[model samples]
Target: MSEMHELFLTCPKGLEGLLADEAGVLGLAEVRQSTSAIRGRASLETAYRLCLWSRLANRVLLVVSRFAMGNADELYQGVHAVDWADHLAPSGTLAVEFSGHGSGIDNTHFGALKVKDAIVDRLRSASGERPSIDKLNPDLRVHLRLDRGQAVLSLDLSGHSLHQRGYRLQQGAAPLKENLAAAILVRAGWPRIAAEGGALADPMCGVGTFLIEAAMMAADIAPNLARERWGFSAWLGHVPALWRKLHSEAQQRAEAGLTRPPLWIRGYEADPRLIQPARNNIERAGLSAWVKVYQGEVATFEPRPDQNQKGLVVCNPPYGQRLGDEASLLYLYQNLGERLRQGCLNWQAAVFTAAPDLGKRMGIRSHKQYAFWNGALACKLLLIDVVPTQFVTGERTERSHAHEHSDTGQGTAGEHPPAPAPAAPARLSEGGQMFYNRLQKNHRQLAKWARREQVECYRVYDADMPEYAVAVDLYRYWVHVQEYAAPRSIDPEKAQARLFDALAAIPQALGVDPRHVVVKRRERQGGTRQYERQGREGRFLEVSEGGVRLLVNLGDYLDTGLFLDHRPLRLRLQQEAAGKRFLNLFCYTGTATVHAAKGGARSSTSVDLSHTYLDWARRNLSLNGFSDKHRLEQGDGLAWLEENRETFDLIFVDPPTFSNSKRMEGVFDVQRDHVRLIDLAMARLAEGGVLYFSNNFRRFVLDASLLQRYQVEEISASTRPMDFARNDKIHRAWRITAR
Candidate 1:
């Protein structure tokens, strides 16, 4: 009978169950599970087979001896009890790893030293020569664990973690370890899907970890087949014949698996830099024929597999770790969900993410959720079936029969008409109904005023109810909902629930498609955070205000290019400026400058620090057929005002409340720098010319000293349009002129 050796297979946390099942299948006896490890008994052949076959295990250790120990002396004695002659020659090199901290061995290094000393002493006394220590690539590697005063010593049968696989020498930032990637694929049921001749794809494949792992699993290729050296290779008791037999079998199986029809496996990565590296990894894995990678973004990702093939879509999208990262990632997840719905019908999907709340915004229902740990961060694996039933659709409106007819202008002739669009629940919750009623009331009141005033964009709701703390704005056909960050006193779950309710009611109340509604979380921004980009969609929509066209990017920026609350001020600039020199400071997107140019300003200069916004200002001016005369200067506003040698008849100064932009020499606080800012603009003010200064700091106090130097009149109320009537502190404006 073959000897049965006790074995321990260590895998990543949360994969013990799967590893245990695998061990039992590989002919291990009495399989047992523990945290990050599986314990079982196997013959030497089975042990070798496991080392080659395990897709999820990190290392496989073969138990050599177990004994009771009370202190370091006992530890030495127990290790010395093992017959060294059977495992290692006296001149052979060895290494030791110690774990746990009991039996008077408080430090791992001390515990390892004791074990090493005992082995060397026993060997040296018998053979007159001692084994040398080689930490890397040792002939014999030993591991000792002190558990509740009992020492269990084992030989490391799998050298260097099995997850290395020898294929991925290069990877991207935050790459998933191979074993964890395998576990994700296993939980995602990639094996079953692959066996059915289905395809696989990864949208955000960083270095193609998932694609290569999935390909190896489908092709019946042993993960460690290409490994040249192992922990037991140089051991005295190593059985080369048994390992060779298993290796031969794996090779034959791989050959056979490859001879069959190839499964379509592909990866798409957004970063062009990772494309060649991912392809290199695929080639190293010997799966270039089956797996391919391309440089593509999630927004345009489409898996073009063989006809009639349906399989899995899996990816580990970045769950941001920095502030304001989640806000931008919302659109990424939304885009991914949109792609899955529009392109990959009747398929399966698994999204492994650390941010489960962002996953909720994907607009799809995950049928099952499994919790796992990627390093120390707790993550969730969302398993979804991309069938029609899993899609989250908005409330359906009644359509006329003529609209439902085919584009050929004929009723169904022979082919079946496409399925009617899915509809959400018609009845809303009580809270949602109340919110919808309030939105309808606000829209009715604001819609008439907006149409009468020729306003295409305006605010409709501004935290009307304490429970639903979100502002909803209408941009023609699109809806922009900004959810105010709830205070710490409110339960986050409750706040999220209220937000979901409000979102469900927004499209219905505003008479817009749900897809046109963009949602963002509004928190108090510090420094230049508000100006920083939140997304990369780069989609700019052209809208008109006061007979002038302006471009607004609703997805890429936190604040759309045009400020809805500042409409009145922009209109006033247009109404008051005629053949006058206009100067606009802190001209974000230069909406005010556009208005001034449209109102027949002789010449205008827009000053800002950001070149990106200055370009945007240039575009805004060009859109209105006034470009050469409108000089767009990119510099610090205060510095530009100081260096100017000219004066203007109309000047609009709307500075941020706080800015610590990197372009500036120092921080600029509106409250602290307003005096200098006003003094500089007042100097640039031509005689008898008007200067309109405004800011949005709620508690801002006008400098009392400026009251005595100039003729100043507060026009905050008059400048605030009707849309912002409810929020009296939205902004403060003053009309100033030379005394």
Candidate 2:
């Protein structure tokens, strides 16, 4: 027997056991599984076989040594102990991939640099030359992990992951990783189905990954046969004759397996440009004859006549990363479910998606679901049998279809036709009808103002009736409704019922689809909780306001990137900004600065405390083509004002009510800190300049002492727009000019 080595095989999360099973099936010894990796004892030939045959494994690593280390000095000593000559020559190029967190070694780059220094010092002493580092394609790749005080160093045997089967050269918008696709197939029980000669189909196959992978599995082809190079190809310890013999054995197996009857595999893609790439990848994988791809939509997809009776229908349809995407996907998913339930009667199906709620709209029940991660996104693979009984009834389908098609024709210039309203139940209370009537009255009054002023997003209703307590705002075709947290004395059940009534009344009275309405609770935020994400739907919509386009995220954050109450103030700044140097303090998303830029400001400066908001501000500026003469800095707003010597003719300061975020040195209270915040801002004001200060604290009171230093006028009444006429306390604005 040859020498035994400790080997570790890493895979995607949730596939650890499957990888271990693959290792055991390949005749390895002592297979064990962990959270995201598998361990076993194997000879050199066994490692080679696992790398070639195992489709789920990410990388095959050979463990060199493990020790206890805490800092950079200890890490250097530990890596220095490994023999340099045994792995590579002194002239060979190498790269170190370092990971893990430890005391005093918190950064990966510093740790990697230390590891590189130790290797070069050892090799330079032995052969009078040191290897150079190559990050892209290195001859030898070393991996080091540090946890607590323990370090495990290993060699990355697989160069660029075994999943890069060399077939997919071009990918679609959001392509699935190859290993993740393989894991999905394994969970779908593809191996067992192939053994029984069942066929396979992918209705929304992007670049033909699932279909090509399925064909290779049925033909018993090695997953990594088409790879151009491997880590061992450059190592000094590589055995050429042994690797050649194993390679020939795999070729013979693939050749004989191809002679047998192949399972019928088909792929359908909606994008025409993707069909050629899918076919090109299929040809590259040497599965051209067995796997076929065609350009077609999922609604009309059908199994071929020569295909087997019952197989697996697997697809990773578009799950919509943004708010707008989710509204459009309900119809696509419903169509897919209809096609499968009616056309492919006896087949089993697997739907992988990040939005399982959208998956539920498919009108089918999933008997089994497995959780998996596609990179950073946690996804699910749902298994269902395509039977008539699994689908929803006719009435439910009709309602779902109506919601899906309401957003059509909404992209035009003129008024869009309203979708037919659902019949109101007889049990609806008088308060609900009154709520509907108020929305209708509000829409009628605001329609003329919205069109004449060119404002698409405005407050329509603000708690008009005491019984219905919610605020509704219109952002073009979509509506956002925020319900205030009901008082504790109110019954939870009654409050919920009132809330449901308000949600139902919004769409019918406004002539908008229910799908266009989003509901959220308005609560007093603590610390930075208001800025935190409410959901992971990455949808952003473009809306017009004051003649400039701004991106509004209706799904992700509590605030839709724009404060509806400050609409008039932003327009005022735009009207007064020509030929002035402008400065925006606490610019949440740079909306004010964009307004100034569009109004022909000479130059503008924006400062904020959050990097996330700062990046958003940059995007907002660039979106309007405000390219030059605009600078955005991210830091403490007060500190920035104290350090800045530049003066501006116009400045806008809109601050949060209370903030105790970690990025700030001290807590901010609009009532307590307003004096100091304004004094510092005034020091940088240019001659004859005016500053507009605004806040959303409803009960705020301005200090009388500020009137003595500057001419202060409360313009809150004039600044409030007509949409907010019902609720005059939405925000307070002040105009202060140097006396």
Candidate 3:
């Protein structure tokens, strides 16, 4: 053993074997799988190679020292005892991470600090100069893991989080961690699947992590091809020539779109919440065409129109396996089973579920029970094969490969939920198409409310802009603005004329006045669909329809003043402000003030930190004939509210979820300083008066219990609009009255 180095690679819980396999591929000898990690012995070059190629590892570590670090003193002494000049110097940068211990030396930050002190002090005393810490992207990342009075220290060879594989330009909420994703693919026998060019399907593919990873493998693309940096590249004795060769080989494998053709991979989700994140990650992965996420449901999904090969349809669903209402989950799984059995016969199906009970409702005997863990919960993967007659398909071609070894178990085949399952009869109207009627039905229910809300929001639009642009002000809906290279066949002029006509015909469409319709336009830049990117690439502003409100800020973006998230807060103002004075601070375009005025407030004052918004507020008031009637002031909201000792019966306070307005005294964090803001706003509330405060932070917490100064009752229920029915608590809505 010519200079043996102790080392371990941290895997995300269940990816040990896969990570070990990757190391073995990279020429590491004596690679052994551990519980949530892997241990391997290799030369420094082997560690660097493994770092460059390992797809399922969080990070690869080169052990420096290990001891029973029970407290900070033990941690400091354990770290300081290492020879300082070996890998670190006063001029080099460093970073540290610690975990696994529940207390004592287990605190990640505390452990990290102590380790930092040890390294810096050791270097300072030896060389009279100390290396600095580079938290953003360190030259050296130190990891310390402790368990049951034992500690392990390793230098991270893999740079950044291995999850940033460089392929995703978009992501979904609670996205499958990259390590977890890799493990899922491996456990589903991706080696066998990849050899046969099988498809991966994610019915509830939040952000398309699994589909992207699988497609990357099928395309022979290097998962790290798009990544910018790696820890091995920053190693003291880093090999630039070897890294370049590895990178070039991976780059040569990258391809756009699906190489196998037809549909080898697909993902579907009903909630729009996952849409943007999914798009971002897909764009980042540069696999937009090979793997795409569609806004859809799984229950009635049909096979691809051009699928002629036997592919696998594997999915992770919201069977309360991780995040969802557990009670409503079993039925969803049953519906998924119905889709697989009735819609896909020539395909192999694998369902991964922590709730094996819910998996049983699929009513298909599992061929293999592969064990895994997502976070800490023990999970199982159930693979199945169905006979062609068991499927209800109107086929046009033959199966590419014969199913020789389905191995669907010989079991009782009737494990299900106790309560009667939902109507999952494997039948759908219109040739098994999804019930899109639900979306339309919800839109229908909110038609009246939408009309009213649009009217108030429109009060902020400039009415003097060009006809095409001004048409955007009258009504908010039925408007689409795109800045892109249009095909010759798609006439922009004709589209504009048609959209204008639609605006004029709004009354006929919805039995409401057409004058109430608002239409606006802005520019968009053409996107390289290879990245699934859809953004207005150039500068454009919300232009009024009739050249009345000539918004001159057309050099940057689309609809800057408006976001639909705060619709409920605006409604709350309109609901509770009758016969009361209202203060609309930070009033961008006086939309809230307009709603308050419309709700019959005695007086409404609109103030904003921006002179542009204040001017827009004046124009909006003039457009609605309230220019002189409404007090429009330009000032900092906090300062203005603080200086004036005035109280209102009704107050609407909705601030930017996060901002650092130099105009203000300090940076604002809604989560951390909500109480201070609320107290300040509530100071202006009169006795028995209602104060409506809301934020779209999604995770904002209001210490209402600590506010013995006021009686807080959630008014989010009262402000629920039809557009936000899917997720009512998308924002926290609360009403407080002086106790």
Candidate 4:
């Protein structure tokens, strides 16, 4: 019988079993799993096989000698006793690493220093020469791991970290460590997701790391497919023939497992800077053909209009807490909630964030929140239901603007802002399912009503989807209501096709030429834009209310470009815009910009942080021919107001529920900073100026004391438009004037 060789391997914590399993699968002998390690005896072939195939392990160590040691000195003696000259030439370079624990060793560095000293000492004594240390790329590597006073030293058969899988050619801003990424995927049960036809997505897919990794898993591709170097390449016992065979086998298996088109993987980012990086990384990972990266805003991001089946959306948004931008983060999350409720009802989502509280701002109770680490920061990956929101149907009247007075002297221009907001949309339901069911019923009823009454463009939902809280658009044609249902598959092409159908139908329904209807879709509101994609082309931006020709193209934003939920707010702005100096704060793309200008606003000022949105506001204004009269300011909403108190008869203050724009001196969270903001805006108020401060922070509270110097009128009811007349206040748009 052939002789068996003794070997030991090292892996990351919790991965020892995987290595042992690999060894056994490769037909090795006596495989065993230990803490951060795997040990076994095998022919040289088994060692090569383990090196080529094991995915979870870090290094495949070839055991040279095993012995007991009480302390560092004894450890040095055991290592020094090995015949170092036999394997490494006197001219070769060597490196040593130490890990694990021992009370006496004190530090891994000190322990490694001792090991290095012993190896050199032994080599010098035997061959009168010693190999030099080359930590960067050592020819012969040594690993010494000691735990609880026990020591195990082995030859590092794998040279570099196993995670340096050659697939990645470039990295983007803060690319995730490959090992950490694999850990995330494994933690999410990637293997299982792939098997069951489950999907994967990265909302802020900086460089497509997650996307490519997802594709690799779906294709059954080995994580090390792109790696050209292996520790065994330099090991004394390397078997090139065995490695070649193993490589061929992995290739064959991966190829056999690859899935066909309608690839269940996607990625998106609003910045163009990220688009190329994501593509380059995926291409390097050999997943470019299978995975794709799209450019758009988070607020406007949409899945292909046709794709309907739900998958998973995983994202790692910055921790707003570090910068106190929780409010904006909250706004972003609230919008995310809206998007999930509307667009991704059949999907599941996981958001990794350092602040769980920030995650709470999402307004959905996560099913599970897993803890993980990024660098040294503690983070949580919240697992959530990607369906519409379900709220208790009552107590929603808070955000309505009905209570405020809209007496902007001109009736064309509102008095100072309207009174504080009224209640929000009513929760009318319990589970998300119930909310969606009720909405579906409402849509059916509305469609029936529109048909029977022959009302063209009758409202489907006037207020926000408090019950199934998300953005939705319903239009009627020649008085026929158009239906935009989610596609049946997670296929992009199919989804695009469905979108095209909706796109074709919108023009006919809206009483506009087909060319005028810009077709767009959103993955989730306040997300990236699903612009004129390959499947559906053109802009879906024209809207009309009461023949007023309200220009809205949800395709232009993650936010439906219209905020149908905020219909009352726009109407309020419209009624007072004329003849008044209107100020729009956090003016996204400026639907408010357009409304204010066209409503007879004498001169309008729009402030926002995103240049992209500022440009969009410009477009909207120009489209309405209000560009000459309106001025768009590129600055932070809060900071701009702090310095520029230009009071007007009509002022709109809707700072993000939270914001972290660098240009701003500090973070602005509508919840904590509203009072100060209201004060500042009111200070500049032309005595009669009506300051309307609205925010989407669901639980935002007003500092009545802050407004004490002024007459605080509860104008929520008066401010809430007819569309928003149904129930609760999703926002608190108020009116304030000096007493």
Considering lDDT, where higher is better, how would the candidates rank from best to worst? 1, 2, 4, 3
Between which residue pairs do clashes occur in model 2? 321-538, 322-538, 322-539, 323-539
* Model 3 TM-score, 2 decimals: 0.51
Per-residue lDDT of candidate 1, residues 1-739 (tens digit): 9999999999889999988887888888999998889999989999999999999899999999999999888899899988988999888999999999987989999999999999998788554778999999999999998889989899999989999998998899899999999999999999999988889999999899999999999999999999999999999889899889999999999999878777988887777788788888988989888887766557567674644679999999997754334334655676688778866888999999998876776768899999998989899999999988997664432321211211211122122322223322223457877898899899999899999999989999999998999999888777788889999999998897687678756766776655567877889977887888888878888999999999998877778888899999999999888899999999999999999988999999999988989999899889889887889888888989888889999999999999989888898999999999999999998988999999999989999999999999999999889999999999999999988
Q: lDDT per residue, candidate 3, 1-739, as tens digits?
A: 4455666877777677777787788777788877877886887656655665677877778887778856778878888998766776578888888877643754578878888898888878454768898987887788878877777877787778776777555564446677677777776676577677666677777778888778776776666666677775566656688677767765665643244462457777667677667777776776677766666555545544344656677777754322113323543665677667656666777787877766755646677777777776777878777554444332111112212221212111112101221223322223112122232233355556645544322321112122223222212322222222334675666444333322322222233322122223423322211112123333323433211232222212334445454655765677677888888866776767766776778888877777767876776656655554578887766778778788877877777666666566776677877787778888887777777777767767778564676778877766654454555565677878877
Ten contiguous residues minimizing lDDT sum, candidate 4: 408-417
lDDT of each: 0.86, 0.82, 0.61, 0.61
Q: Per-residue alpha-carbon lDDT of model 2 for 213-312, expressed as tens digits?
A: 8898899999997786897789877788888888889999999888988787888777777888888899988988888777666655676444347899
True-structure RMSD, every candidate: 7.2, 10.4, 18.4, 15.3
Q: Residue 166 CA error for candidate 2 (Å)? A: 1.2
Question: Estimated TM-score per prediction?
Answer: 0.72, 0.60, 0.51, 0.51
Better of 2 and 4 by lDDT: 2
Q: What is the lDDT of residue 228 in candidate 3?
A: 74
For model 2, the run of ten residues with the poorest summed lDDT:
410-419
Q: Give the Cα RMSD of candidate 3.
A: 18.4
Measured on C-alpha atoms, candidate 1 has an lDDT of 0.86
